[model samples]
Target: MLPPHRARRAAGLLAAGTLGLSTVFLGAIGTAQAGPTGWTFSESNSPITVPSDVCSIEWTITGGAGGFGDTNLRGQNANPRIVTTVVAPGDQYTLVPGGAGADHAAGGQGGTNTVGQGGGANGDIATGGGGGGAASLVLKNGQVFLSSLAGFGGGAGGGAGGHVPDSPSAAVITDFATTPAPGVAGPGSITGQGYACEALNTPPPAPEISVVPGPGQLSVWGRSGGPLGPGPGVAPVTGYEYSLDGGPWTTVPGGATHGMATPLLWLTGLVNGREYGVSVRVTSSAGPSAASAVKKTTPFERPGKPTGVSAKVGPSELTISWSPTAAPGTYPLTGYQVWAFHGDEVDGFQVYLCEVSASVHTCTAEVPAGVDYAVYVEGVDDKGNVGDYGWVNSAVVPLGDMPATVPAKDADLVGASGPITTVTAGKTVVLKGSGYMPNSTIRAIAYSTPTELGVFVTDENGEFEVTVTIPGDLPAGAHSLVVTGVDPQGDVRHLRVDVTVSASGTATVTEAALATTATATATATERLPNTGFSAAGPLVAGTAALGLGAGLIVASRRRPSA
Candidate 1:
């Protein structure tokens, strides 16, 4: 049917008869009509997008090969019985099973049951519709292909042209009974079977790729196939894959040579020249199929720089090897490396081709063979790229014994960060030291605090450091640090550390009290203490001697005193 396009193209078109198709390769669901034919049958194709559930229009009825056996056949139908009914949208249907009534003898050729669909030949009463050839169906979209009506009419021929297609009327008729009567001579005959209700989709599998050659190994090839016959419009595709260089693409297994045979499958080793690329992907469960053209292969090529290099002296130790830099013609080498130098102490070498790819010259170690070392070698190619220029000096391998004395914090050893005992004035105490044979004549002196005790000197990793920040109060708390380690063979080592003088003294309030001067002084309490608690007791000295002995005498004069 092909019309309402919302995204439905799962295609298919392989026509013939019996209408029975189901291969879920998807592509299916309504709309199809193909019931009309006269002759010619080359097995048509090209209409494939079947996977949408697979149900566009499927057919296979073919059977027009019984005409050469003519017995004056008219409306042939010795006993043809095919009654499929269902017709609305404008009715119409017929079924005339009444044809073999006179000297009958034509029907028999629907072998293997109904293999290629063709068997209905025995009807020659004198003239009338019965040649057998008109009734192929394909209505899927809305469905409708009517044509089948052979009622009693053979006074001159004996009808036979009703294969019920849009059909209807005849209701239900499967009558095939005729053995001895009506014109006699040849009892019965009639055969033809094929169908198609709608359903055709099986096309999507054709991808390819190839490249074979493996000893060292490099092989890859494949292809996959599917739709060819089940016809409709666009059906016939096959593809496979293989790629490199840019890389990434592989698929091919027997998708479609169109017919059927084997396919292709193999992948090994790979790299031959360099630029390896390929592509192919054509698929049409019923639609897209067209994209192929892109292939390249150098698989081999490269001739130059990469040759003999050896070194394995032993005294101090050195081992190295290399070869394959001779490309006069056939190029094929993938790795080698070895590099070392002592007088100048060089450093570079290690290359093996493919996988870890790096090995240009040569390398095998064990120079501890005891000292004197110097070596070099390199090589690689197969797309693993590796070569960073290597070969430094100092390859001197006297190994063991001469490398242990550089320890005192070896940069060369020469430390002198002061006898920095206690420091925290300006806060810059960091006299670290480092020195190595830099002409090792190092020096560092930084003493700080009191009597202008502050100093700083510098040298190298033989050891010399200076970060002096302790110059203000030389006499506060704990302070005693001195470090000096030198070696020009004078060999003097003295380093002590103890510093803790967090002393910061400042406090003054001379004699302050002047808000109103007299902080508080109302000492009038003496009024009661004037003479009470101080008495020796004894009734206050007998009441002060009876008030001065009763002032007796004084009374004598005072007559009233009597």
Candidate 2:
């Protein structure tokens, strides 16, 4: 009674619904038949297998139970209700179970003939016995995630040993929680639980550190507090951080090898005489711990040497001066040392003359006259550190009173004898002189252009003879010679002389003559004093001679005549 097309469509829809229901029923039945497998850990380790069809698994893990001890001191319970998730698991895995801690025995009474029992060989005798920590549970060949508080185990109390007269009874000690069973796995959802889970995700505990003064003022030591133990759950301290004088913190890269007994870190480079505050902290994968208490210290160092040293010579004292040292601010200069030593003498000794304040750079010290002296200066710091000596400076002091200037009348200049008035250029002239300071130096300088000709030292009697060569370049004319003398005390005397220069090769000499005439008158005024026939005799003789000469002339005339 229905249409053919409509009836065929309705029948097709009903068949499809029936097939869908059957498929769902078969899937449910299969799932119900394949239940989750269970496993218990009796040995230290065991193997676990996952079903091939299973895609994920939920795990509940707990640590082993603790042991019992005397004085009602019960062992601690294992970590409880730890939940974890494993995704995509179809392979074998290894499971490790924790072992329970051992129980402690109480001490027995001591007496002769009856041995007394020793204290329990577990934990401290007075305090409750300690419980062993739980081992970690690791899942392999599968992606596993743990909830908070999944790895921690409680610690056990110490057992009471021998009873003491005044001490509290051993029964007063109370028991802690009992240990828990090992972990189990099943096909179920894994959800994080408990307040401890939230705590486990937080950063690890910070380490404790202490700093001590080292051998040198510039050095310090950093010590780390040993391993912090609350069970296997807490992370260990890995490295350290330090700061000096309120400076930025510096981190040490490597972790400590000995937990609480880590070696001390030797730090250097601290400035001397400077106040410093140091601090340190611990670090781990979870982050860094808070900074430790600050430690204060001061350093010391030697000062630098002084520079720019100089010495000024006086009649009886030496004035030493120097520039301020470029000392560091940490070790400021406190004073200066002035030393005097004999020139060219190193007897391993020096004269420490005096000390001057830092504000002053110069000092005066008395010295013997006529002696050469070498001087040095050094700087001293507050810490008793002395700097090296500065550069050496030398000076000589004058000895005695200076001689007076020679008077022109007291000195003379004379040339070698015959007509030696003239001199030629490039010829030697010998001269002599006296009346100068004995044992003094004399210099002969030409007047023209003030050129030096020669030098000589006066002998014991203050007299000298010197030969001087007229310079070829000297003008051929008259010139003056200036002579000077210098005594030991730096006094000066001078003398001057005039001389002429000639172009002729030889010296010329000249002579002059004188003539006289007399006349007489024949007046008989108290006639001339008696002379032995002088006047008349001379007249007669002259007449006779004349006659003879006349006669002879006549005869010659006649004889030229004979």
Regions of model 2 farther than 4 Å from truth: 1-267, 275-298, 343-348, 400-562
TM-score of 1: 0.22
Per-residue lDDT for 176 in model 2? Answer: 26
| Model 2 per-residue lDDT tens digits across residues 472-560 | 77765555555555322223444555655455543221211111111211111111111110000000000000011111100000000
Q: Using lDDT, give the best candidate's number.
A: 2
Predicted structure 1: lDDT: 0.29
lDDT of 1 by residue, 81-115 (tens): 34332222222111111122222233322111121
Instruction: Assess every candidate by TM-score.
Output: 0.22, 0.22
